[model samples]
Target: MASENMEISLPLELHPFVIRVLDDPDLQQRLASIVEAKAFVEESLKVAAEQEIPLNAEILASTLRPDPLGLGRFTSAPLQMDNWPPIGWLPTRTVQSQDGTPAFDWVWFGPHRHSRPFFEEDVRRAEAMPFNWLFRVRTGLQALISGYGSEPEVPLKGLIFHMSRCGSTLLSQMYASVPDSLVSSEPEPLGGVIQWIRLAKVDQESAITVMRAIVAALGRDSGTGAKYHLIKAEAWNAHSIALFRNAFPSVNWVFLYRNSIEVLVSLLRQPAIHTVENLMPREMVELNDEEPRSREEFAALVVAKIGKSIITHQHLGGGLVIAYPDIIDAATTSIP
Candidate 1:
């Protein structure tokens, strides 16, 4: 966070910095390595400063994340976490706080109407409020297990898996369209914890415990609804099917896939964060540290990797497979 007295102003010339920080691979790598949030901001300001790109804390802060649920006067009033309601706090990221214990940072996503492709577009907005940097809060890993605000009555309906550019979001949306159902597509905290688990940042028992906590939080039941809980994991998350299965054995699941040629065309036209180099860890997608022949080729391999993982795990008892063309029908008839 910039000093409160640092003249909260963003120069016109620095407007492009927002787009650059999120879209530029090198810039993301440079900032992501910083363990401390404040240090991260300071380094970001310096990057723009050294390049002679006019910038201020405000401008830089706005591009750090998605959803403007920060504790600004203009934003929603935040309820204290002491007895926090499940619906009020949205888990934003899984992080190890200054204490070195793994935890999750939460933000507000009120009843406000939101943009589509929630994680992709909303997170990409880089929408941040200065207040967020000043007073962010973290719910320790135990809160997830100690019984969050409240747990939904029903067990998870099913998990939604997909190759990106496929109809996973569409199907999840369809499920959300139904009355009393809550479909969270590409949950960031879940994705974040999965990465950390793979990186060995957390032990196995704790990882399983927190994952259950996360799902329970997402499945919060406020006494009346969300009888159906469906989470659409990221394309690369196919590799974690066993993790989810281990943590949620009885929960049903479905994997949606599409034609590779069409998937490649979609990526070539507009690359997703996972497909872009440095945006995501290569090891998460089974790629070696050596340079890929091409970004396009790398993306294809990533898509193939996800497909192979899906094939390897789709036979996990309750799991079902659905092709892109048959998604709507499959979701309608196949998902119970």
Candidate 2:
């Protein structure tokens, strides 16, 4: 295809080529079949060159990635594109705009191939892929430019929230077992967007727009032609249940609660991040302050606030209150 001696014309941006590859069923299938990381990138580059997509190493290597030392990160060149296609990419985190506005840091995720217990875990794997390491990180208003007016390919059917040590993951796993389901458990990007809204980093209009847009982008169907999408939010996120309900008025949700003693004991054995004194803010769980509270006390208060918040907002949306026992019953009950 391209050679050192050949003077090939390269495009100003790489999103169009990436979109073409991801949107084409045959091209995506062939690329997805490559098990070797290097081979995947090589093949993708080859295909781009063959299609005269103006492929070049300078642009390919410019994709963002984590540095080996974990000190900071490797950066990508600024990409110039009008509107981004939602087929293959997803927002990884939230960033600040030059004008102090909130924005998303988009990344290449290829397509949804596997459903991990947590959506962030699936995204982490995608980020590590050699194919994805070639992603372009465009600056300024990528969210607004990408899928601004589009709806999710798959329909969001349910939202699962829970108290710590509950059966939320198991519930999501069951949904994931169904072949036509797209389930994202505790996605990081959703949390990021929520944080922006909570902090008023984005105005209400833009907040709703990005929040809806990100969920739609995540709901994109993989090759399985998945029809249903569900998200199991982080346990601490129960504090923001009202915000979520307001954002997705029609989406049904369930909050899974467990015995306080059981949840306390579980957290005592192994403390979750939210259980730590300063890790999560007191305002989040409705505590007066972080001081004077032991680990056990902190866990108890957080769980209580989470439950209270959920109960308060349960009337909104099509909210359902489900206990941990009910989750167990639904999961373990065998058909006669």
* lDDT digits (tens) for residues 78-168 of candidate 1: 2223332334235656666456545666543333212245553433233253323422335556555675435343346788888889898
What shift in Å separates residue 72 of candidate 2 from its native position after superposition? 7.2
Q: What is the lDDT of residue 51 in candidate 2?
A: 83
Query: Where does model 1 exceed 4 Å of error?
Result: 1-87, 99-101, 109-116, 119-136, 148-154, 201-203, 289-291
Best by TM-score: 2
lDDT of the structure predicted as candidate 1: 0.64
| C-alpha lDDT score of every prediction, in listed order | 0.64, 0.65
TM-scores of the candidates in the order shown: 0.68, 0.78
Runs of candidate 2 exceeding 4 Å displacement: 1-29, 32-37, 40-45, 48-82, 96-101, 108-114, 136-142, 201-205, 288-290, 331-336
